[model samples]
Target: MQNILFRLGFLACFCSSAFSGVTYPPITIDLQNKPPGHQITEFRTLTILIDTRIDVININAGVGFFLIQVHSYMGNITLSDDSDAQISGTNIGLIWKGNSENVAHFYLFRDHLALLDNITMLIAVSTYSKYDPVPGGCNLSFETEIAPYQKISESDDFITVISQPPSQFGNFCNRSNIVTRMYYLYLSEHDNSTEQYFANIQKMISVDDIVKYGTLVLEGLTANRFKQMYSRYAGTGRVFAAVSTRLGRSAAYVPAVSYGCDVAAWDADCSGPGKDIFSFISGLAFALLWLFLWRKFGIPVVAVQLAFLLNGLLVASILFYSQLGDIYIFANDATFWTCFVCLLIVTQKPFGCLTSLFYIIALSLVGSYAVIFAVNYYVGGNLPYILLNTYRRITVANFGSAVIAPPYQTMDICQTGLWVLIFCIGVYVQTRSSMGRPPFPPRRADRARARVDENTPLIEPNQEMPPAYFEAVYS
Candidate 1:
């Protein structure tokens, strides 16, 4: 009994340390006033942003490995200043997580920080036992790696290794509700001078790009304050951050400069007030038609969808032949068409109720597409081009042949706002309009009543039959 009690007490102590065991070197004592960094000791996760002034953040984890991710979504992890030193020590790993813009530095290794504005993510994990670099990318479901494990003795313990390759390459990520831009940098260690690191990074992200996108400065208090924040509010912000981020960014991670629909087209063809006006008009027409006529005239809307789908399929085939956007884009659109066709087929018999659901989905798509096209066309946002270049790939999908989609500072708020607004309204209006309505047309109630009356006798059961009734019966 005493031994068991001792074991329980030791386990409690170990657990406490594991939950709050990150210790920073004494050199960071002066930064006692800034905002605290984000940390979750349960996963041995710690994230702190360093800028021009500060240097030398050496985080030591207790009981297990530390996972440090310098991601774009949580704000950038910038090492702009030349004087900045190494942020982490050995046995710790860094996951240089982000989209295509931020992940380019995956090969740069550690002990070398650079002026990072955009590097597409490459996930690397350096465990105390060994280092694993996942060239495929970061998995958002990676928190499971830190789950409690059963020990099979100190020398040979059991651990779970999970890797979920993202589906965004073919536009599958958005459908599964995954954010491709989020990088979870597992800690790593290597030897590269800061100058060489910056130079290599400059090759991909030049000074001009930095000047163009501007810089992100994340302020945090001393490493001690980070500890305090972790103890006080570690897990609470993650959920809110995720929710707010998804709502803010159209539920997808759009890269800074993606392949535009008219990627090789002339500048004038891609953007103009005239084109914007036309796009706006067409988009508005489609949106209104979906709102008002989809329930009443679903067949016409479906016909339009079929036309677009066929065009998209043809464009995808051509793109495959030309090698324009890559096979993933082709595959993505093909999947969409296949799924839609299957939905239509099944709605005929076994699941006729699916027709109503199908209409709702179709309406929502129309509304969202219309809004996204108009807004992105006007602003030259990357999303519209991504839609055409990646998911739709339809012939004549150009926003404008002469226009180039410029990198925007942030997602056009108006676009996302209007997209969401229009989608919600479409869903609400269509759903309400469909209430108490049958999924398919039925015989008129009055007609049914009339038919019943014609089949019945014209006389009461208990009374003497009328002469007319008898004559009718004889006839």
Candidate 2:
């Protein structure tokens, strides 16, 4: 115990040096007119000294999770703190938030604006346009709060996002007497209202942390930056939050009830004492990403990375194997979150030499999906319907079921499916550009040179080549 305390002291000292204080710089987001919406209102401060990068400990009051959103940057990030984690070797479902083998916790995800670097990635997703275009440049909207989901977390029902501290020393969910500092997210009008319902569980966070030291990335991303993030963690989903806005006047923060993974609704009317509608779409999005990675990265690396990316889950599976049969969908998001981060940092350049086919297959799916999803967001209520509607989930959940009420007056599932098929063509086109290309090959000469560095036997051309050549000629 003394040694453990000593280690804790050492860690705290190290963190104090590394991320102790905060002086986060404000990033700028350039939107065409009307940057501030009605949703950017009210303020409830959180802690500043916690970290939500790798380990996700628990989902309790004010300690396990927190949401950091910035409209100016087009980012919707969720930081989880689980001291305990676990993973498995399965391909269909791997890492999860808790100990359940079948479930995974949903970590936070963000989608940055497309124009940040002005360089379009050659991804092939079917949900978005093949050549989906946005503004020429991108900027982080520091003043805006685009996600409404971040708001509904202050309080509510079956889906409780723990706000106060936990009770037990190790029990992060029970303590409520303490207060700290970190990042805080406000709400906005032109944002994904559904996200407001998704839980932004945290322990203790404050605005001072970001306000004090978070550096503003002003130069914009270069190809090198993308390469670095990609090579390390190349993945299938959009990884940045493009904007944020908080509106206090309209929506009141109310906790909603939940039955299993499904959020409790008043009467399936899609309204009443519930949260934002953005969550369903966001959930669908990350799911699409998971599918894309499987198709692209293949199974080997995916398994290895998932094991590390979701260590908490691996721990849980080992300890909770007996209770595996019963777990919530919320417990399954951990693997999804791992896949989420993997999507951000994994890139194509690394595998370009190892295998081009894999890269082509992976990027083709992701690129197509991204293009189509973006197109759906832009269409507003004009084009909608499932099995084809680009933003079908959003429209269906928000308005009604597509089976009953289609978005447009005259578009059946078949007609919408045609457009979806058309969008898929664009995905194929972009994928053709991104796929089926040959990866880099290791040359014999290069290998020989590298071997020389390792004190390996040299196969000199002058000595070995002549004999081999003579043997070949004679033979």
Candidate 3:
């Protein structure tokens, strides 16, 4: 009887070892290059491999889980952080199944992080067993250490790295606040790369800090300039208030409530070029030049149009080249070239009603946009959506390296007043100047009359003989 019992015990041990090997393969998570703590800033794919026996679906708030609220903004569904709130992605279905494997993968649908700014996602790993959550048959048995394995292919859409929650976070299946690790990722707007090092999460910003520095507003602060100054503070987990207003009006600042990158990281001052002073001067110069000399500088006006269109094409080409391997829908080079050829044909012809009409419309728009762009630096303003998008894309494409500006949002009475004033003035001046002008350049008779006025002799040197002279000789 004793010998038989010993053989049964050995057989049981051998079976247990074989089952463990089959269930949990080697999965090592190299946390060396990643940001300090649990943050993952610059990864395309973050896969969390949890044991199949862990019960993640029925997590309870009493077990350190926080309530999440959903809201709608402008007809789009959104998540809100209410008082005593926390957020998660998988709960709301943001993380979909990338493969049949039991791994958690988060795929960010929005390309622009600003759209999802100020949002934090919590990932909870419960210790409850899937088979029995009633405090019985709890299988807290898994490998403690995992070895490194092969990396996912770069050619694949998602570069995958398997990871598991740190072992230090002890069992929280039945208790509250056993251990919870907060992580953050500060990503660049353009390439989703790490902007800077992650800082300790400052859950609260002092009232004094908000008043003394956060609410301080700068004069002539442009969206671009504001971002340029504040982006350095990104990932530092600082809080501040941002104010956009007209004519330095005292807009109430909303205090920062959460910790995220660039929530409102505005500086009191910037050393770069002053926004209003330079843009106002340059924009005013262009508007005034166009307004006063629209008729005199017709060819130059056409040239400017050419330059503008060509610049747009250049930007498009650069964007296409930069995103060569990525998939995106943008205007092709052939289409842009075709449009360029068409514009050249239209603008390069001799002055006519069509050309004159184009001159008035194009110059008026240019003047209007320039004035608005400059004035918005001092007083926040709104521009037409299409024009604004064009301006933003061009500006960012050119100067994204130096600074990244947020999209414009403010719209007030001052912006409308200035835009109307400048646009009307441009149209009025161009119209009054162009009145009574011939649709086409002067005909031969008109040229002859002008030449006679200039005291040219009737029988001139080597000129084509007039019909009158030929008729006399033939008769």
Candidate 4:
């Protein structure tokens, strides 16, 4: 009994730690303050952004492995100083953990401590575990490494564009949806520091041409308290955009910079999200359609789903041929396409219903594609991950001109087409079965054994019937 009690107590503690284990290090977080009049403590930090190839290197470890797991949903990160943290010792190495909502961030790996403004929140830990790189104490020790970021040629005085006009890349830039994508490509490819923060630009190359250009794209999100920022800065006349590289450079690609004013920047091409994606309201309609004219409408309803398949296909094709945004529109459109697509898919029925139940899986794709899918090693969650969503660009079919552009997103387009075809065919079979089969059939339980002699013909109901016809006359 005592042992069991001890075990239960230990288990409870373990569970608690798992739920709120190591103190997660946040970017630009405010350290705890002392009593009311106490002077605020300050820390020194420098940042240099650099990207090194992910060739496996042996890391020395003294504290079992101090992994730093920093998480953020808003893709915005700010660094006040020079570069990423440097890890001088050969023994100590960095490991990172990405949140279900965000993989684009890292406190685990070495990156520049670039929080233009630090957040004011301090989280302390209750226990000493191997996972904390950041033991918060009076004397905190930090590691450092020195590596140079990918550099652009001095002559390449390029511009950063957040969004172009309708002339955007389909997968990366969409005037209709995305304000901007975090990176031109995946997180790994961002080693080259060619990208700038809050940049939108004309496509010197297609969205998929990151490899060919060998450039890094820094056009990420602004998780900054935009509402507060505008109220304090833009609202109070802090012309950050005009002053900083965030906007207003008329060279290579950066055009007229704009803020996220819903009214001013209304996406004219904003055809609303797909109808099936908005299928929740359709539930009542579908029920009524079923109750009143189930047969008539069922087939018709399926036919109407053509809009879904087509829209999904349009989004998918845009994603598939993402680098070829010139064919689709003016600015890069990938990010907006993903954002809008996810919003619609997650909102609608069937798909929306699945979103609630699917848990981590739901996070794997759909809504947070750019953030969550940035590191997708191609396994793509429960379903294949997509440059274009699987429902549409279903496969990783190779596309693009051989010399200039890389293949759009990766997947089996042929397989996806085959599956969609099979699904439709299966639906057809089921519909036919529903229409042909009877809802219920009769059961034969009420038959009594009646025997007539072979020699005697059956009598009419009106004729008198007797149990013993031969003896009837005498009886």
Candidate 5:
């Protein structure tokens, strides 16, 4: 009877050991501020003190190797005998206690688990802030080498892990949703190719899986925060398209969202209207200059014609290139064409130097006032002012919607005033020079010389007999 009791007691003890599971304490290590090239030798090890059997030991170093073990909870089956085993590349070794009843300790030695491809290892040990709370009772480190692990979804009590990779690990412990933010960690692995990285992203976006994941957030990785972020992810048009479609208009990390429009569109809107005004002002100024040159220096009609023809060719070339290449060159062509047309009209009619000068001054004054009126009209919320209307029609007829009215802020009123002053001064200088010059040359001496008649016969030096005949010839 005593022997029977001893056997029953031993069986009860064995059952208790089998049912109990090992619980590890919460650990957080912060390696974010660690200096580059610094090596870490010691880690806060997880030790098993009880005489409990370690059914399975799982270690995921992220990229080098993947080991999976499956065992039925109802049966005592061994999935893998990792005891006394060492993993290559990582140089990871497991130490078991004497008699092989329990695991003694687990540790990372030298640079064994220091780095991995596509996996960024960060230690946030015992660090707390208003934003991030401590993850409780979890000793294992997290890795995102697999595409599915790239996103973490949040709920009230737990967070779901999803990725493009086949393996599916259910919910992770998040007792109170302590980790409210998502961090995109980038690991620099020389052997890792960007092709696979982009492929994973493409797969995730195709199924619309990223949208189901909670809000995606990224911390600044460099000094140029926006530029870096843009270059890293948003630079890809496919990624941008996915982000825009999934998040609607509320998504973060999109460079276009920060501004009202994309870079090219914003530039066009800001410079469009201003370009129109500038072209008009340029035309007016050129007309004034043409008048001054003709009235003051007397530029010949042929010279004026040649200048216009050359200018027209140049403007045409600019337009052609703008159509074939960049749209910005349209501004230059518009300005040139406007000026060319103004000059052409003035030169078309035959006018004397004085008449042309006065006409140019009058035209410039009227053009300046017209500009002020057009600016005021546009500024006052009027659609299609005279100048803008004419410019828009021309641009649309030629370049489609490649050019439009620029924003009001781009107009330079002071510049217009300066050009007008220059025109007025030019006119004044020409007037003064013209007034200073004599209308015709003096002819007093020429009139006296004309009185001697060449037709009269010359008298011989020896003969002086024909005085009355010489007087008659002189008269």
Candidate 6:
């Protein structure tokens, strides 16, 4: 009996060893570069081979089990298997079946470590069977270390980075916080390649152990290039703010927000509060020139009409290039229809120029308000919707670096000023041409009577002509 028991025990041990699956070694993921931490700018993806399990036994039993559990303080996490199957939830249970053996592959996606100093990820795996439970079930576990650099400050245009001093080191040895501020400037002539752009960024932070700031001016970059750079480095914990200049107003600052990149406190259309004084001046000059040509050389009506059409087309083209085509088209149509109806009403009347000028001014005012209302409604009551949409579309379309919104306020002010100036010119012409006479020319009969009276000379008081002579003279 003792010999038989011994042989049975030996057989059981041999069967257990034969049925067991291959066990994978613990996975050690080192994210440390020169920084000694998993310092990531945007996001990271990791894949690990968990284990190789024999499915023949489970396939016959019609029961199998695979499980993975991840614990981390990272921003967000996603897990998947080698078969492109998404494992849902933090504690995941993976199902497996079939006659062949299979390897369990796990993938992980980690979010940005915006403000954290360090993050740890722990992964645990276990597999089992519902029936014919195998003695000594296999369980494996591993841990991944992630050290995220702390963010100092951030804006739409740039982000600042600084190393956190050790908690135990007290304030005495904690060298001045390595504060590095990066500024982004969009200039008219700066066009930097991707490598050059990144090199420039790195140069700003190259100085050792000192508080420093650097400016990166991107000039004339295509929209795609600009957006690429903006997205790549926007969240890297290095940029501070991107600043833009206007003709009359103070610099507009764009800060990065969690929702997306945007200009803070500024209209999406870049239509700030102040008038575009330069545009206004230019419009006034053009109107004065037009008035001079009209008064001095008597410009033809057809020529005037053509000029108006050309001006409209030019303005529309400008708006289209500036991504404000919709607004411009709306305003132009409204102005045109309004002026057309008003001109028709006064077509037969004299002083057409003066009447047309009045119509232009009134239409301009009405059109301005109409544009504002339409834009507001389209933007869902947000005044800056144009500017915001402009940025978003450009970025998404990969034209952000190349395309930019013109100063909408300036365009509006200049357009209105041009109409007002034309009106003023009309007033001046009327005043100068009809200063000492009636506004309308005298009738032919009146002119003839005046001439006869002048020729008679002093006949009113002393000399009285005969009735027949007077009748002949008047006739």
Tens digit per residue, CA lDDT, model 2, 1-475: 5334434543564466468465322122111221111111112211232111222222222221122221211122222112221111100001111133311122111222321322111100001111111110111221111111111111121111211111212222221232221122222211222233121211001122223322122221121111111000001001111111112111111111112121223223222222346966886897789767665544545643443333323223222222221122212335424543454345433443544444444444344444444454533222211223222222322111111111122212334465557556655675576444323323345445445465555665555344554444333
TM-score computed on alpha carbons, candidate 2: 0.19
lDDT of every model, 2 decimals: 0.30, 0.26, 0.30, 0.25, 0.30, 0.33
Q: Once model 2 is optimally superposed onto the true structure by TM-score, how far is the C-alpha of residue 354 displaced, in angstroms?
A: 12
Winner on TM-score between 2 and 6 is 6
Give candidates' CA RMSD values in order.
23.3, 27.0, 20.6, 24.0, 24.6, 22.8
lDDT of 6 by residue, 121-237 (tens): 444332323321111111111111111112233334322322222111111222223221224322111122233333333322221211234343333332121122332121112
Clashes of each: 33, 135, 0, 56, 13, 25
Best by lDDT: 6
Q: Flag regions of model 2 displaced more than 4 Å.
A: 1-355, 380-423, 426-475
lDDT of 6 at 90: 21
Off by over 4 Å in 1: 1-352, 390-409, 412-414, 438-475
What is the TM-score of candidate 3? 0.31
- Best of the candidates, TM-score: 3
lDDT of 3 by residue, 211-233 (tens): 44332323221222222122221
lDDT: worst 10-residue window of model 2:
228-237
Q: Could you tell me the lDDT of residue 184 within candidate 2?
A: 23
TM-score of each: 0.27, 0.19, 0.31, 0.23, 0.21, 0.23
Give per-residue CA lDDT, model 4, range 1-475, as digits (tens). 5334433543454455458653232333221322111111112122222111122112222222112211111122211111244232111222321223212222222322433433221111111122222111111123222111111111111112221121111112222331322122121111111122111221211222222332332221223211111100000000011111112211111112112121122232111111233555675677676556434333433433433444344444444333433232212246535654674454333533322222222222232333333223232221122332323222222111111112222333433444455545544554455453332211222111233468656766666654574353323
Provide the lDDT at 268 for model 2. Answer: 39
Instruction: lDDT winner between 3 and 6, please give it.
Output: 6
Better model by lDDT: candidate 2 vs candidate 6: 6
In model 6, which regions exceed 4 Å deviation?
Answer: 1-255, 258-274, 301-306, 311-475
Worst 10-residue lDDT window, candidate 6: 139-148
